[model samples]
Target: MLTSTKTGTFRFVLVAVLMLLLQACQAGEETTPAGANAGDETSTTASGTQTRSDEGGTDGRGGTLVVAMTAGNVPLPDIVPTEGSEGRRFVTYQLYDGLVRWDLSRDDATSVPRPGLAESWDISEDMMTWTFHLREGVKFHDGTDWNADAAVFGLDRILNQESEWYSASLGGAIATYTKKIDSYEKIDDYTLAIHMKEPYALLHWDLTWVRFASPDAVKTYGNDGYIQHPVGTGPFRFVSMEQGVNMILEPNTEYWGEVPKLDQLILRPMPEASSRLAALQTGEVNWAEVPPPESMEMLRQEGFQVLLNNYPHMWPIILNLQVEPWDNKLVRQAANYAIDRDGMANDLLGGAANPAVQFMYEGHDWYSEDGTTYSYDPEKAKELLAEAGYPDGFETVFVVPSSGSGNMWPLPMIEFLQQNLAEVGIDVEVEVMEWGALIQTYRPGFPPGENVGGVMVSTGSYAPMHAFDRNFASTSVPPAGNNKGLYDNQRVDELLREVQVASEEEFIPLMKELNSIVTDDAPWLFVVHDLNLRVVASNVKGVVMAQNWFIDLDTVWVE
Candidate 1:
């Protein structure tokens, strides 16, 4: 049995070995022309070898770049992604432009909000009213000018129920992010002001999800038609789509920002990790997301660039507070204690992850040093279960997605957890569902089933307030928001409210306190944080491995 300290040492050694392997593999190879222009800083690894180019320039820009996505089905290109974050990463992000966009041009840290369609913004003294200055001379893929009316029109599509294009599903998906916005008014053709219900401090972060589509396109095509022919002011424009197979996009030459180097971008839905790996090996795809963990070493040795970075991602079993034994905090904490996160991270995931001590990874600004840490202790787990009046243990079902987005080997990881829980007298019945279907189960309270304990899903804690509010706030339950677990504590609600209005200096301490309370409560079985991994073909150039769930493709080019 490896102790936590041993697990840390093992992870460090594993990373060192991987770095060494990468260096040796690329030693005498010809330096690939990075897509960086003159005067731009090219990034180099520890061995001083060029890895990616910053916003310098494009090396070659006429090739088609095909990427294998983890999603089983192609995401509908729309403002709201039906397939969850995976959909946003591959489809929506390429076809649409948000008010604020993630800074995906760098790989050094987690992405932060940068100006997109909106050039800059200002907030009132009370922080209730936010005015945005739209970018000039920007047009959607459809050639419609992007102005304040278009921005308000896009907002109404998801925010206003009375609007013609309002979709209950799309609106529901974005409600948590835009919950604070009470109304919007056009100050001018290129200026907009959003009036909030309160002094919401995370409005800028929320704006990243409030993407805009061409209002004329939506009206001409209607909701269903627009999905097929989505038009936005993004670097890529929708070209064609074949559901469950592939969606092709072409470069938006008139893009407001950096134009995509590739002439075409093809996103293929390949749910099976083996299929994705094979595609990368067979030259069918230049990039593959989340390759099989077991194939990492072989791929690295075979000259594939296996990129890894620490990101704000986690895979956890969110217990239903509405369910029987899971309703007890002791039972939840016991389950966390029973599982060997270190084993799962090191042995099962091949050191592609780290044990999660809190919602955010260690060293994150919001990560709490005082938070509860659940070590591998079967005895402690059994004791807690007995105290919770489940002396003989309990039987429950854990629903998990087949494959999608940041989900890292769901079946094997869950099975490993199933065995661990069984040893502590908990019988966990595994239930696997497709990624899209599993995402649908997130709404409408607890999933309908007999003795359903929880659901294993990958979630991101990119912003502390957004994460805590969407997952734990009582107001976020059901059709209102994404509190899938139905976790409602008054203190949590209060703290979330404070976070909503917390100042820059006050946010961290408040979140730390909030994290400590949630960690102690054990609302979910804390699992492992994903070390965002992907495999790119050797010929792929200028691919910045940004430390976020999403990636920027504008700079990437194929040799």
Candidate 2:
């Protein structure tokens, strides 16, 4: 979760020098060059000696947490383009705190939204207005007071038509957020009121997208300058970012909440699952992202901890409704029925994933289990395809990402899907490209003449209704939004609009109705909802993989 312009060797050298300087100044602190080392048990720095604990964790204390992620090092994280912005959230989530944050402690059975920068909120009886009571005395990373004016500045940067974000990709990516809010008003120095154009069903979910960046920092550093030097109110303060290498984050001891236990948090972007797993195995890192499925037992046998947490990630084979046979309802239904989701969940994925029931999987209060979840009916699939005039099936590209945790193993998952589809006479040629390229190919008009319509493997969203806004809403079509399938149903669009304004009591049923309608339309081949599997050094403690896709490293301590 770190970023910067310098990459490759220069980034490495700069980090080395900074680390060396840190070591010479350490009195009892552990400052070492090998803090970023990937394959070693003993790492000695300039100041103190640091050794690996065989396999344990201890009470919260100051140490260092080195994490390897399966993502590219992004230069800057756009708060607007929350989806498919690569490693931006990984950086921003730690560097900045939102007014409302998904309760990471809640399990898959419950969605408990937590108060963040704004300690409390009030919604009007009509549900068109929301008043937020901001946390008093909160300060940005630069030691500036966090008040209504600063918060409004960040919101205006996104909402104002003349702002830089409005003229570019940020505005387009966040179209889902913009169309809902009419305007905002400052009630007091610490209170803010949000006026909605209409009743929005999930204002709390939408508020989660906002993170108040310091107005002073933005004005002083400008747009490009802010990317290099991000300032926020989170526990970790940004130090340096070396693209594709490492990001250095030092603890903000003056953080408003519980102080971060780690003295230095080093985030390394390896992008390769094998490399990330290798780093965890060698004791170079305390935590890591997705590891190779085959390495789980090996890692556990060697005293590492392999945890599979149920995350709010849904893997759907996005069906391009504008394309060939997919345009037919029967053919789309056939695509859904053709694959053995249970088999994929159990055999191919080694039971690390669950067969999906709907878009808003369990735990979300608005989640629906009433949708018609497809069963593996090979005969039905073939019969439907024959009825749709694709008796001999057709050839199409199954676009997948080469990196990231969309699927446990994207290539293997594709192979399994390929095999399953072949059983029903559908031949799939898997196109495994970079994560960024995969995202572009699906969006409406960015890549020009590319064959944008087809099957795209795996999509994830932390906010269920927001996912609908981007994927199913009328406005979310290419170039502006990520409605990859170009799926638009009059009823669905209407229900989504209603869902936005529906109160807490009215939200679930509306979402349920929407889910049933969308699944019946078959915009996507409903696949398995993935479980987020991670490998960590046994010495790593308090590292919880929240269903909201956050790795809580603040409490993580080295034994």
Output the worst ten-in-a-row residue range by lDDT, candidate 2: 12-21
CA lDDT, every model vs. true structure: 0.77, 0.65
- RMSD, one per candidate, in order: 9.9, 12.2
> Pick by TM-score: which candidate is best?
1
TM-score of each: 0.89, 0.84
The digit string of per-residue lDDT tens for model 1 on 481-530 reads: 66778887899888887776665456667777887888889889989988
Q: Which is the leading candidate under lDDT?
A: 1
Clashes of each: 3, 6
Clashing pairs in 2: 199-501, 200-500, 200-501, 201-500, 201-501, 444-478
Q: What local lDDT score does residue 471 receive in model 1, on the 0 to 100 scale?
A: 80
Candidate 1 Cα outliers beyond 4 Å, as residue runs: 1-60
